[model samples]
Target: MPLDLSRRSLFTGAAGLTVSGLAGAGLAGCSQTAPSGTTDAAFPPGAIDPHLLGPAEGVALLSRNENPYGPSQSALDMIEYAASKGAYYANQEAAVSLMSMIAEKNGVDPEQVVLTTGSGEVLSAIAVLYGPRGPIVAPRLFWDTTALYAANLGMAEIQRVPLTDEMEIDLAAIEAAVTPDTGLVQLCNPNNPTGLVSDPATFQAAVRRMAATTTVLVDEAYIELSDDPEANSCVPLISEGHDVIVTRTFSKIYGMAGIRLGYAIASAETAAAIRPVVMSWSPCTSYAAGIGCYNDDAFIDFSKSKVTEARDMVFATLDTLGLDYLPSQTNFVYFKSGLEANAVQAAMAERLISVRGQYMDYNEWTRVSMGKVEDVERFCRALPELIEA
Candidate 1:
């Protein structure tokens, strides 16, 4: 079936743009760099298809932020061992133990963390809990999933906040965008695509000024790769009794994406509020696998080291190309070509390599994920031709 990237949806954009108005326009005309007062939808419905690009046929450097090096051997061994228990439900004691491990690492109580299918699932849970018919504020240039998740909850009043020159969150603008109707505020720290991180002081100020009624969610999906995880997280906000949720993913630094484990750290009260909405049964076997994988401190440190190496390598390549990119603190880099990004992505695809497309700012920018060293070389080798052409 052909998917419709059209505006024929149950919910339309509020304010200046509608699903119908932005359907034919690129992301530039929408959130990323859309003119102020314009609320062009960032992603038209059904724009992405994982099936459209398969890993077996070619290297999908496009969504390459996925940890190319997956789980540690011990983690994989545990997964295989768990597979043998397929006939039975996993032990609840083991699952709780895994949750406790994550809580311990983050300095939170086990009861204050709720395990989910993945960090992505946690975002969905948030949308359902706070969205559906309210104004919400989020960074405009970001991973599209957050906005899509919000829209899925029937949110029509999605306000776009632009990134500052340094690619950090525009805290002043975010504070200004908040309205009484704003139900939630989302911050993707060490943000996806761009890999830019916000300083802690700015976050504190944002939380301080945010309407007391709005819940702030810090999606720390890539905090492990960041230079200062402690100073850049909102966990303190949750402890201070602010309405905050800090979501961490095992998929990235832990190399557990396939294992499908992520957890949200919050006040016990916030966790309790989200508990009823989480999927009651999250494939028990996966829980067992993640427990053993995340338990090893040595494995965690080693994985972080590797990601840091890849991040620095990619940044060097971007510099060599003279490509303008955000100073990445994550495993990926977002670059702007000052032209249509899809053209460059198509050019890379022609070489059997893929890069993500960005539709922001009426300019074409693309985001490339750092993979293994060899994959990075192939992408870099193919770049001059595309950029010069």
Candidate 2:
């Protein structure tokens, strides 16, 4: 399909704010108690080579959200076996078996599951399959790389809808942004950076509203770590006959960030459409370690518990510091420290601490991922001073 490159009309409506951060009334504080101490690892600035501070060190506070924990034990075991057999092409049996387990787990058909190097690859696949020169609607304040993929694929018109005053997606604006050229609609749950969820009703309504023409994408990369995993997912919408595709990642919940495994769940037809778009090699055996982790009952339960504990700890710390933060259901807290997020983030780095500086969209809010219990305590103590700095 040829790419479309014309600009669409500027969205000017109550819902078209074109940004994420907004102040609203009566927001209740998190229902958790604060922590103490400085368990957070120091990324002392000027101590380590500046080149070493990659995105990981720059946003160390939100490490957990980015799969800092690495692969689970079972995943490691699988990787060992796969590496031993590295002489061969990826283990097709392992891939099929992994897909089977994923399908069974998600209550979908194996045919409906498509593995990719990472969900990022899946997103790129979506752009290729659907990006034949039309307007694609996405939130204005969204994951930095999402729109880039579409635009790279020759998407001429990129419609960016803003967050509402309450910091949720304005579905009406999304609708208004859609035009005949509209081919895809991508949305994230408990959205990236800001950490707000659209709730079930709003999600269902948005999909229902978009079903007439567009292929709706629900990116649930952080869904597993969220407060209500089941409620915040779009899997139910797929089951209810919407033209929706839901993508989940093992990187976040299974702690296999290094393995780089992610899966997409959708209607069999949609999945079929996406399969051809996926890279030929598919996911490799080394990346299949996450499959082992997903299958480990003990590890899955423990991982979920750890996430919950960290969520409470971070939220409590945010409250004690008197910082305003988006209510996060995911593993990170998106809070504004009444300071330039980058500056405070830099100061934290000087203390050998890493926090995700809100760049691009919500620069005032810094997103800190939930860490070990002790880490949570250290951040609690250091945060007040950093924010005040």
Tens digits of per-residue lDDT, candidate 2, 231-312, equal: 7777877778788888887767777654667778888777767766564354455456856677787776777787678777
> Against the hidden true structure, what lDDT does model 2 obtain?
0.67
lDDT per prediction? 0.69, 0.67
Determine which window of 10 residues in candidate 1 has minimal summed lDDT: 3-12
Per-candidate clashes come to: 6, 17
lDDT, model 2, position 184: 81
For candidate 2, what is the total of clashing residue pairs?
17
Q: What is the C-alpha RMSD of each candidate to the true structure, in Å?
A: 11.0, 11.5
Count backbone overlaps in model 1.
Answer: 6
- For model 2, state the Cα shift of residue 389 in Å: 3.7
